[model samples]
Target: MAPSNQLEVPQKSRVTVVGSGNWGSVAAKLIAFNTLHINSFHDEVRMWVFEETLPSGENLSDVINRTNENVKYLPGIKLPKNVVADPDIEHAVRDANMLVFVTPHQFMEGICKRLVGKIREDAVAISLIKGMEVKREGPCMISSLISEILGISCCVLMGANIANEIAVEKFSEATVGYRENKEIAEKWVQLFNTPYFMVSAVQDVEGVELCGTLKNVVALAAGFVDGLEMGNNTKAAIMRIGLREMKALSKLLFPSVKDNTFFESCGVADLITTCLGGRNRRCADAFARNGGKRSFDELEAEMLQGQKLQGVSTAKEVYEVLSHRGWLELFPLFTTVHEICSGRLAPSAIVEYTEHSARLPLLESPVHLN
Candidate 1:
């Protein structure tokens, strides 16, 4: 349960959003949904807006006053109006009490660096993106990356759930991990928790971040097996093994988080979503169907168009780094998938690796196979 007495929930607060992409847009919408009291404090409180775009490409803009009826992605629901989109990075962080990052993981470091001087020292920083650094960093997770760039500790918002599913106010669960400061963590949980959005608070930043980050790897493997047209028996075996791998890595990397064993929320829950709804799987499917001719970027863009999910370029990056380092003990399926993606091994090799690495007995079929 979230502690109400500890969190400082302001009647109205300014939140600066860093990105306006699919995830960014959903995050901004959530900010508006959670801060519905801003109008009550009209003169006293205004939700100031700050939004940023990629520098090299043409500047991007967000659709404001977009209702669920108007927006195709949004379900039939009403949206709040206080949240405004600003293109200026400096102006966005200026005087804002909360900062939320929804950009891709690769772009977050640079974006945070740009706002380092401008961000209010007291403002809470939160990142919704999940992935590891492209470059070598020993034991550094997404939270550490944010702390390094911002020069301050920040909380992470992550889970197995997807944005489109959340945007529609579907019933789902997520975990908010923060430092030992239980007060700060609960505040965030309360801020985001609505009728349909149930949030759990964790003192373990590493565990929470790892669950969010590593699930992509497992999901990629799941996608590979699924794309191979492996039956549910094979898919189920992969999922169970994937959970064990996640638990082992979690124990090694983040011992503080109680119960590293993956459950529906962290391990099993997120893995299935990513493998089935995940964009990485779609990308893998494209490669499998096309005979691996197109470039990574082309396959990724095509997957996004069809599935409307973020591409897993960063996930593939992490897979490569870990596999090269010989840290393949925990996530063997991921390692296998990585090999297939890199052209070092063929698709059939994935099945062979899983059979070789798995230690537990294969699951018995619950239904008769045709």
Candidate 2:
């Protein structure tokens, strides 16, 4: 069927972005471009906001920077002034066509819960998060949890693409998963599709979400390998095992998604970047570089004393959840977790473990199912 005027043209498309971190800022900017590219807005890109953050890193920013009031993060990007930075929830979601969530994984559910009271039923919600909620039985996958709470099926965007690369308009590609309806899913793919930013559609939202979340775990493992002075061979070995562990864990959580290859764009692509970011890896690297170096607690305390430790608590929660399940055979990277937990296994030992566990098969295709 041809796209009717009603479907082809948005009735009234106003997009609101929920977070203002690096990914959030980049995504909000792109969505502004997407709306403009579709010619869906006649008078500027519908209102957008960076949604401010509080001092403790909570997203409730009380002090607004008037100097940095414009929505475009980079100068000369030429964002339409219509895309305003609104901090109020009611003002942001009111009469909007879509809401995009770009906050940290742990914060997504609470934010989604808050939106339930505000957003209209017809409006579509998009999740750009890449981690699972560390929970038992249900709502483990991020999308499912949001969809269930919102009482509407939510779509997810995941891929090997990076924020910095995309912000500069470099070549990038991504996969959009919509479990609600194929037509709805394709609408987003077509809406944001551009020559440089290739977008594909997939019905396996579970696979996409699980892959997105699990790869970060593998990244921590890779960082551990890096901390240990592991060679390229060792790094490659960790990558292979990491993908397998992702496959096994994803299989257990989202059985609906049968594709087990975690080496795809969303899996391995995201994995490499997370390792290179060097946050969690720094923890291991510090331990590896010095002998009888500061204990984990001492290192964490010392690091927190100087710079912020963002994801240590979240990573610890992930480790604890995995341990509670007693699902060791399912997660070979849990070997890395065990070493981190046991206090006996040094950073170098993580490299040896990677070498020992490197026999898993490589993924056949870099891309997963459609």
Candidate 3:
């Protein structure tokens, strides 16, 4: 009662989403809804748009602001009114203390370059993008790239998150992976958790992120099985084998990865959903049906509207890493997916390596398949 002059007001965190594609729009909707109800955040959510001219000749950001919907990427879904779309990348994130990155992996390096020295010094980032950048040195995870380029600590959120279903309020779960800060991880959990969307946090950043990245390669294999007219049993075998390789490769690259992380929503669950019905799987199916005559680029243009496919690109990236390190034989499904995608091997080759992979010993060491 005697400290009336010492009153202090806590600062609320402002959030900006750094991409405006399908998943990005859904993420902004979720964050905007929570910010309005949560006291620790500002109600306004700024979403950065890679501006495009729609078929109606209206600028995407302008239309999003006017209609409260992403008329191009996420049509029919109503974005919250407070979710403002801004075309200027720097301006969208300039004042925000929390950044959510959901862009394609191929474009992230350029985005980070443009954002260098532009974001808040104290800002924290969370990557919802699930792919890696292969460099001459090695593979770089999205979260690591953000942290390295932006000078901020970055975390990752991943799961069996099919954006369209979640946009409609279907129940789903996600896992947030943090480095050393439990408090920061919990904050992300609180921001994304909703009645229909359950969120949890785990300490294995690499494990969670790799699960999300590598599963797309496996999904391509699953799609091959689908296109080849393989029954459910064969698809199940591919998924099981793919999961094994996912766990093996994750631990091989980052020995600190925990085994229990494989049981999380980001692990087996994500692998299952993506392999069954994800864009990668869908595209791979079409690629196989065409006897690999049509390239993935052609199929992508026909399908997916304007959205991007992470699997084919990720498979190539992973293959580069494996080829450079002489570990190609260690991951058969991953290797086959890249070979098939690049037209070196038929799509039917997805199953050719499975029997060999299944026979390999457990990957207790780099020489075994534990």
Best-matching candidate per lDDT: 3
Which of 2 and 3 is ahead in TM-score? Answer: 3
lDDT digits (tens) for residues 1-370 of candidate 3 = 6687986989999999999999999999999999999999999999999999988899999999999999888889999999999999999999999999999889999999999989998899999999999977899999999999999999999999999999999999999999999999999998999999999999999999999999999999999999999889989999999999898888888988999998999999999899877999999999999999999998998898889999999999999988888789888889999999999999888888888888877665753522
Over 1-370, each residue of candidate 1 has an lDDT whose tens digit, in order, gives 7786897765555666676555566666666676664342222112222333324342323433333221423335444666655666787678776677766677666777787788878777777777767565545666777778777767887876777787787887777878878887876776667777788877777777777777776666666677677877887777777766666656655556556425536556777777677666666666655655565567766556422333355456657556665566545676776667777777666678788769634222212211
What C-alpha lDDT, on a 0 to 100 scale, does residue 125 get in candidate 3?
Answer: 94
In model 2, the number of clashes is 0
Task: Give all TM-scores, in the order shown.
Answer: 0.81, 0.77, 0.97
Q: Clashing residue pairs, candidate 2?
A: none
Q: Report clash pairs, candidate 1.
A: 50-92, 51-86
TM-score of 2: 0.77
Counted clashes in each candidate structure? 2, 0, 6
Task: State how far residue 46 of model 1 sits from its true place (Å).
Answer: 10
The lDDT of each candidate is 0.63, 0.61, 0.93
Off by over 4 Å in 1: 1-12, 38-79, 134-139, 306-312, 320-325, 360-370
Candidate 3, poorest ten consecutive residues by summed lDDT: 361-370
TM-score of 1: 0.81
The prediction achieving the highest TM-score against the true structure is 3
